[model samples]
Target: MNKFLFKVSFIILFLFLGTAKTFAQKLKFLIPDAGIVQHAGSIGYFSVGAGYEIFKNKKGYLDFNYGYVPAFKGGELHAVTVKLAYKPFEIKLSDWAKLYPFNPGFFLSYTFQEDLAYKFHSSEYPRGYYYWSPALRPHLSFSNEIELSIPESWDGLGINKIGLYTEFNTNDFYIVNYLQNTSSLSLSDIFQLGIGVRLKF
Candidate 1:
């Protein structure tokens, strides 16, 4: 299982690097933006990465992040995640404040840890006993963000905008469990909340 995971991770890293190289070649003049996240679903305790804004108006984005989980929590976990998000419309509250009512997205993450198995079966168990993999986690979420613009004159830095966002998410395993026991499980039991920030360049 560990060998399989290593192969998978290597392939994914290769693909990601290839894609990033192509994107950079296509947009030679534009610089990629970066952000930091904390406690996001399937992204470990904290993450930092770079991303590119897509589309003519820059309403969509693709991000790649590397996250870490400490040994004290539940052994050490190192994760790589790729996320895509879209903001359809933005509401201007004022000159300095803007609200993005909805930013729906999905993320795929893989954790490097031997203790967590991709399959849950031993020689004693029959075939197809447990189907879900704990090492590879996929999540879907909806979020809202409030952006506050920073004036260039206040600080000569290149950062022009900062955003605070909150997301409500659910994983594949949680959804499957919820479907099997709808009578016992509540919505809150299957859902998780994550909050983070974005800095625009």
Candidate 2:
């Protein structure tokens, strides 16, 4: 509770102090999070991102975000990794339901810096180089998420939304084969269970 309040306060303070004279729209802040499915164990991560939804005249909306997710340099090896997503789902969930593909969402993101391999057993693997070359770097990701929201959960604005992201598809990863303690592949792709909140206008 304390942490949530502090973040909310910071968001409000920055929203006004940073860009008060920019536009005429309700300021929306989001705290998005999800659990990582791992072979060893699962860990939770949270990201704080705030952006404006540019409402068009009788049309769609445009949104932007800037945030970061932190973790151990080897956290990616222990079944945990963070992704920055720029999600642009339909503003009206109910309206989209009437269309094909049922409930859906898609996002584009770039990682500031991601852990590619783990330095297991302290000295079991060399620690001189911790990250793979950007060419072989598997830190960046572009994953599209789609979820089925239970009826009556959304008032059409996507606010106070609750649903299950029963489908997840992220098939991109960068692990170096020649790198020590790092394999040719890491457990990042495939579908998993997900739950998130959408505070939209």
Candidate 3:
């Protein structure tokens, strides 16, 4: 179970920016903490995987991602995520900051995820848990994402958008009866902070 993630990504586009024909595409490896909300303390495993992004003058764009739980520390939680993004407007933000801003690109988004949660019975193991919200659905969900970019651009090393890229999303978790016994909000808070590198064009 040493496998953490397996994914391939690409950015395709159609555009008439009026200045010239330009295309943008990006691929990234991401780690999703699908099993984070189950933890009592902050002691938990990290998420890792890859992703792809394509932006055409910030007008038309598409993104997709997939990930797996690490076997070294995360052998029971097997998760995969796929997302689609389409932007119809232009937004801007900071580029180089340790703490990322509270904004992102893309006006609307659709996401579908499949996670195989791992259950441990050993007392030596921490109580395994999941991150589920709205606690009212059939375990499947659709979410929305807001984009926040760099505050300023440097030479070209992506020094501004590195270390931790934050995205405030919905916490969609699933358990045998855990979330079903929680709150009844339409959406939950999802704070994704992972380690990775970012590149800009």
CA lDDT scores, all candidates in order: 0.83, 0.35, 0.31
- Per-residue lDDT for 63-133 in model 2, tens only? 23333333563332222233333433333346433112233333343333344322323465575554432
Q: Using TM-score, rank the candidates from best to worst.
A: 1, 3, 2
Residue 3 lDDT, candidate 1, scale 0-100: 100
Top candidate on TM-score is: 1
Candidate ranking (lDDT, best to worst)? 1, 2, 3
15-92: candidate 3 lDDT, tens digit per residue? 234223332222122322111111111112333333344454543223332333345753533333343334343334
**What is the lDDT, from 0 to 100, of the residue 147 in candidate 2?**
32
Off by over 4 Å in 2: 1-44, 51-101, 114-167, 173-189
Best-performing candidate as measured by lDDT: 1
Candidate 1, 117-161: lDDT as tens digits:
666657755768877776888888888889899987957777778
Stretches off by above 4 angstroms in model 3 are 1-55, 59-62, 72-78, 85-100, 104-164, 173-195
Please state the error at residue 4 of candidate 1 in Å. 56
lDDT of 1 at 23: 93
